[model samples]
Target: MTGTTDTRPVHDGHHTVGELVNQAGEQLSQLVRQELALAKEELTEKGRRAGRGGGMLGGAGAFAYAGLLGLAGTGVAALSLVLPLWAAALIVTAVLFAIAAVLAVTGRSQLRRATPPTPEVTIGSVKADVEEIRERAHR
Candidate 1:
């Protein structure tokens, strides 16, 4: 007989209960961390959208104020001289108001898009993960 022998433990595709339990715990921890990270990312994106919408709304307000100033100039021009000067100022004021209206509409749409800031996708993923874990646990 040859004097050489291999002395490695064979793997039988089975784990002890303690090892399984430990593995399950680690997996659960990892799943929770992943879910939290996903939630954080979703919330951060919503916050950025809200900020942009708010800034646009602020710009609309500023434009509206400028429109008010232009209307005041139109009034002064109308009182001082003929229709041409006042008509030009009125046209400028109308353009300013139109721009403000456009900005207001755009900002409102952006705000609507950012509404209901919840981690909906992450919530659904976590619910699915729970169901899967439950089914496996039963098995």
Candidate 2:
């Protein structure tokens, strides 16, 4: 028998170089698409959560304002029992303004704690992959 190896096509045929490259390209494309879809999903979820949080904050602020108004009304009612009606109203107004200022400061701090929108890991990874593809293409 000849001492030569059989490099021909076998029962399970080997892919050509072109076929292998095409398969790789297709896989890479699929991976990138999946990553992008995941990123979009994450961003949408985060946006929804942020929206809900903002709505809750707004509701809280409205409730606080209403409470302050109620307090002022009570103050006016109390002062009216012992002083002139107009003087009582003015005092109530001043007290309400002070409460409003305090609430404004607190609301501002809560808003400051809110985080800005940002890309998550999926987006970052996709970007890295794109950069790598571009670099490889250039080379």
Candidate 3:
């Protein structure tokens, strides 16, 4: 077998300068289409993940609210069992209001700590892909 392969340029119908330019343009168009499709898929996946995260957070908030209400009800019932009607009612209302305020603060803290749906990974990936394509095109 020969060590060096044939180096002669083969003419496969697209031999003219215009034809070569047209071919390159077509390939570039295809590359853009494929990249757009990939971006769409990535965005769709990211959107779904964000939606699920939001739903889970909402469910957690609802559960916490229910728990706070239950605790407040228990406190009112226990106090009413031993004290005068009006005094017990006042005390229970005060305790329940305090509990509610605490829960509100806690909920606000949780929300503040929650991670935002920034699509960081997806955007980074797309930026890398765009840079790569730009480099390849320049070459």
Candidate 4:
């Protein structure tokens, strides 16, 4: 027989077992880091959107308070004189209420979009990575 010695089972040429293990470890580490970064980015975006939505809601509350004050003014004007002044106050109050309604609707929509705040894209990517790793392991 030739003087060559073969101890390892068949493998793809060139890379030894230790090299393959090390490469796999490095790749796994990189994948984990990337996934964490993606999750952080996704959460940060969601938080910003949520903050904007909350701010709009707070503005709605302020407008609603202003509408209440206008309504109080309407009552005072109505008691003072039956015509003109109270009507104008009523109109202003209606306008303030309308603005509040619009702000509430827009804020609610923004909040809905931000709900279920999870790193969905990162989750899907990680799931796909797990499946790929499983397939490769089986092979």
Model number with the top TM-score: 4
**Between the candidate structures 1 and 4, which one is better when assessed by TM-score?**
4
Task: Return the clash pairs for model 2, or none.
Answer: none
Alpha carbon lDDT of each predicted model: 0.84, 0.86, 0.79, 0.86
Rank ordering of all candidates by lDDT, starting from the highest: 4, 2, 1, 3
Q: Could you tell me which residue pairs clash in candidate 3?
A: none
What would the per-residue lDDT of candidate 1 be over residues 47-119, giving only the tens digit for each residue?
A: 8998999999999979987988877676757645755766767666777789789989998999988746688
- How do the candidates rank by TM-score, highest first? 4, 1, 2, 3
Model 2 quality (TM-score): 0.59
RMSD of each: 7.3, 6.7, 7.4, 7.4
Which 10 successive residues of model 2 have the least lDDT summed?
7-16
lDDT tens digits, residues 1-139, model 2? 7799887666467888888899978989899789978888888998899899999999998998799779878889999999999999998888777967998999899999987776677868888888998898798
lDDT by residue (1-139, candidate 3, tens digit) is 8599887677875487877789878976887687677667877898998799999999998998899778767776777889866777688788778978998999999999998655465567668867987898798
lDDT of 4 at 22: 100
What RMSD does model 4 have?
7.4
Stretches off by above 4 angstroms in model 3 are: 1-14, 77-139
Error of 1 at 121 (Å): 1.3
